[model samples]
Target: MMNPESLRTVSVMRYILPLREGGSLPALAEADDDFKYVLKFRGAGHGVKALIAELLGGEIARFLGLPVPELVFATLDEAFGRTEADEEIQDLLQFSQGLNLGLHYLSGAITYDAAVNDCEATLASKIVWLDAFITNVDRTFRNTNLLVWHKELWLIDHGAAFYFHHSWNNWENSAKTPFALIKDHVLLAKASKLDEVHSEFTQKLNPDVLRKIVNLIPEEWLQWEDGSLKPDEIKEVYFQFLSTRLTNAELFLKQAQDARKTLI
Candidate 1:
């Protein structure tokens, strides 16, 4: 279980450079703690909702013993990024003032290459299960969103998970989805232990555990584009979506099992 107090908020000190790998244009930045971080701007494409998913997904993965970079609430000041040369980057920083999401930067980390690296069945299964539960659609071979640092696999860029929030309609029903996207998971071929990990992961993620992770979302990040729901209500929806999905894990587990069968 993640302690509510474990997530810290740090102020962004400097904009180091833009990581152009993804459309969101997340940047490498330095924080007040004097450590480098990969900063996800709230002003980016998906906006705060993406940040919300990052917090929920990353924390939930950590709760399940997955190796994720340390997550923090990074605040951007208005005066920062004034000297940037790029017009696109300058606009991104200008609109991205206020709270954002940051992942502790792992120096000398290389992207996970399934073709070259070997992953045990157990770890692969756990990762597939995590992506399935969150309805992540970005972990396909084309964009693995995984990093290997010091020979340890570290999960990153969870902003693409929990995609149901992109449209708030029928969120409860969304929880019942089988998340067919699991078919494209980079680790699907090696995830032979999905069933075993599903049972163990479900047990570890009780209602209390889910609530603690959901509660980590900052109120500022809860602004709905439709303006129909308040912050607390929005949080409740996320909690309900996750909890209901947990109760219906079989739906996605079956989908994953069937997908793996085709791959193997």
Candidate 2:
């Protein structure tokens, strides 16, 4: 059993995780003896690529008042070194006491049923579209991108974000997803479901929460190798997108308002 409390920082994560292997961000992490405080950092993000993408990307999703995991910036000093647990840190991270979105490890509960989880579909689609615009490629199905907690689906795992290449001006390849929100996606089916749960979900997220998330990104975390980027510029664009994304939210509200018309 290795003592994570004796470590000084994750420095970097290195392991051949066989869970989700495809696209760019291949899942890779090792487990430690630490009971529940596991830290995860993207491979490329460790050296470059504005690590803020993970923090603020979740913020953007939350700002839309959609179902997203509870995320925060967690630092593991060298005191928190590797444990002698299994082979992957993903499992350790799952049991982490950090800001989690109540994700429970279930063997057969996760599925692709549409009607049962339409709201998740809609939100996931919109996230895919928004991420596409920002060039994020971490919300696909392979990574167990979405998790169900207490019967509510929450989005997670956003390491791959803002990957725009001058050589190619199109979205990169991705895995199969139920709902596709490319461009101006209309989440009609899921929007209808949100009509009843808007108050419950929207109350957890707002503009202020979104702003707070941006403040959490460590300055050094945003440094890149090729050069530096104006994260501030991207932040502003995020706000603008927030303004428009709400329209998609309004569609969900329209669903709720319509439901009020019925007797049941």
The lDDT leader among the candidates is: 1
What tens digits encode model 2's per-residue C-alpha lDDT throughout 170-257?
A: 2222211211222222233333334344544445545555455555554454333454456564454444444334324544344333
TM-score of 1: 0.97
Cα error, residue 75 of model 1, in Å, equals 0.6
Candidate achieving the largest TM-score: 1
Residues 24-58 of candidate 1: C-alpha lDDT, one tens digit per residue: 89999999999999999998999998898898889
- lDDT value for candidate 2? 0.40
Please give each candidate's TM-score: 0.97, 0.47
Off by over 4 Å in 2: 1-39, 42-50, 79-144, 165-212, 228-264
Give residue 159's error in model 2 in angstroms.
Answer: 2.9
